[model samples]
Target: MASPQYRLVYWPGIPGRGEHIRLVFEETSTPYTDTATTSDGLDRVLAYVQGNVPDDNINPPPLAPPILQHLADPNNDTNVTTISQTSNILLYLATHLPPGSIAPDPKTDPNALFYLNSLALTALDGLSNEPHDCHHPIASGLYYEDQKPESLRKADNYVRVRLPKFLGYFERVLGSGASGGGKWLYGGKFSFADLVLFQCLDGVKFMFPKAVSKYEREGTYAKVFALYQAVSERPKITEYLKSSRRQKYSDGIYRYYEELDIEP
Candidate 1:
């Protein structure tokens, strides 16, 4: 196989925020190198985070990892076209890659991109960021043990309140006829939004298995659960899940702590 035209720079050990971008690449079969597994990859990743990339042209360098760089063009500095932020990277891929890779063509339906983006953003907000906070409720900069008391309160509210709110919103979106009343999140077509939501749901299931089980048994968010099943069973995604590329959840966005577990 030919070398990938892109490079993904992110931390090596945990999937962290990079898994979102990885899903897009996996679903599209878009060949790309993950810097995490490469030699000095972490060092290279920190270079961008620390703004030590030796390039003076990359104005306002990215503040964090999961940076995507276009390697196909040599004239452009490796860091010149780098993009960070999971949602922003997904948007760039959705627009730049071949049609049907992850989303519909932006040329045909420009507005759909924004709409899908909004959906992705919402998922990250509720499913990703909030769950992460459940473990480090006081401050991400501090250890979970340092803020155990606050984390317990946050986890209770999240599983009991916020989780249902977000899930219900997506359920309505699926049933709203805006998704063409289909399994997809938009235009009755499988797009990046579906992929993103699937990942978020997967993370939630891992972190809050009991709560998700209760919700699934109630069947109130049937469409959301079905979407998760559909995305997981996709041939490419299925293969990706079983492959080495699919990183296991650890201390990342969705972490399961026995103390944080609750019955919803």
Candidate 2:
């Protein structure tokens, strides 16, 4: 019997939260169809968010894009399992994908998966989500222009305080010896958490080039910066970075606005 195919439903243009899942797929060389690049990708993505895709499996429906669906047959929904939320999708994929693709085996280290999930969550909360709010400080419903003044103030504290605090935390994690005393975020093996942190740092560096560059130059978070470099240089990741599949940063989770850009 043939194996099920993984399908990723997300927005077409920007990487957004979906990029974290995409990196896992790419790094692991997992075969999956990304709706964003398909002919009717966005429409399919909206089907889930709009409650148009009827599946008895999903209750309450999903509120946004970046949903993952496992299909025994792409053309049939009999054995379909759909799930939303980036971290949830990553955790699911980590366990379902081939061994050593992106996570350690839970059978051996029972706490490994949970620990990695915690790490990924921390990176998302402190780096991705907070950085996004720096541009839309007042409200997600309001446009960046509508909240520019408040955004500027938010960006100031983010760059000077929050950014470093998060970076420092990760650096401490790397040096803590709890991560199996290696570059990997957990168990001394490459896991989804490492990818999460790498993507978060990549987005932050793009959005706050000045602040990130200063920190790197000063070697304040050397381990954190080093992890970024290591992940960037990975064979598959290097190819992905150069490929068209890797989307550029824009008005997504991490946005660059000169008015809101402040040095730490």
Candidate 3:
């Protein structure tokens, strides 16, 4: 089969949901273009969210950014196929890459890519719960100050209960040697799942250092952390992370709100 042409559209600021897709593309050394490059890039992104997104599909995507345009389609000009849910995007990229890549063969392998992705998705869901508990006041759309009391209450709960639960899961997964009996998230291979976990870990650590510290006391998942470092340094990934398209943590979903910090 011919190499698949690629173009990735995502939000302009912050790594957010798009970073996972970016990491997957980078890891495979697949050439792709970043569609959102400026504040205007976000404008283009918003339009897709509100207008261009297909509503009639059996599996309509849940949110925006990280939409992959499959440029290799022959039946149409730049035929677009979008999959949201960060984990789903990761799974898609993992299985669809050119043969003999990082992804294990689903038909013959003892551990399937989809199964590992499912586990990683569960971890991500837990991480999101931790963040929401840190700042969920009246609604997700409001500013932290707008929900200070609720945010404080929620953050308190995160430090006490939720943080350990999520971190513990990762620690166990690593210790289990699930990644092909090697280090990392699953099949011991670098998959999109690892990128998602890394982003979640980075965001939580950035948001709640004290809580993260407390969780770290249970012992850091050094294997996954090391894998993260390795993936970050990959040629294409390193370039994208340093490029203008790479958003600072300040903007978008995973804000480093000072108040979100709690005493360990």
* Residue 106 lDDT in candidate 2: 79
How does candidate 1 score on lDDT? Answer: 0.87
Candidate 3: tens digits of C-alpha lDDT, residues 1-264: 444466677876567667777767766788676765544666667877787655645446546666776655634544566666667677777777864365677777756776667766776777754575466557867777788888888777776777776766676776775656536667666656666777777777777777676655555656556655776776766787777756677655556677767875
Runs off by more than 4 Å, candidate 2:
1-4, 57-60
- Computed on alpha carbons, the lDDT of every model, listed in order, comes to 0.87, 0.87, 0.68
Worst 10 residues of 3 by lDDT: 71-80
TM-score of predicted model 3?
A: 0.82
Q: Give Cα distance to truth, residue 58, candidate 3, Å.
A: 9.8
Over 73-125, each residue of candidate 1 has an lDDT whose tens digit, in order, gives 64444434778889999999988889866778877887888999999999999
Q: Which residue pairs collide in model 1, if any?
A: none
How much is the lDDT of residue 101 in candidate 3?
60
Put the candidates in lDDT order, highest first: 1, 2, 3
TM-score, candidate 2, is: 0.95
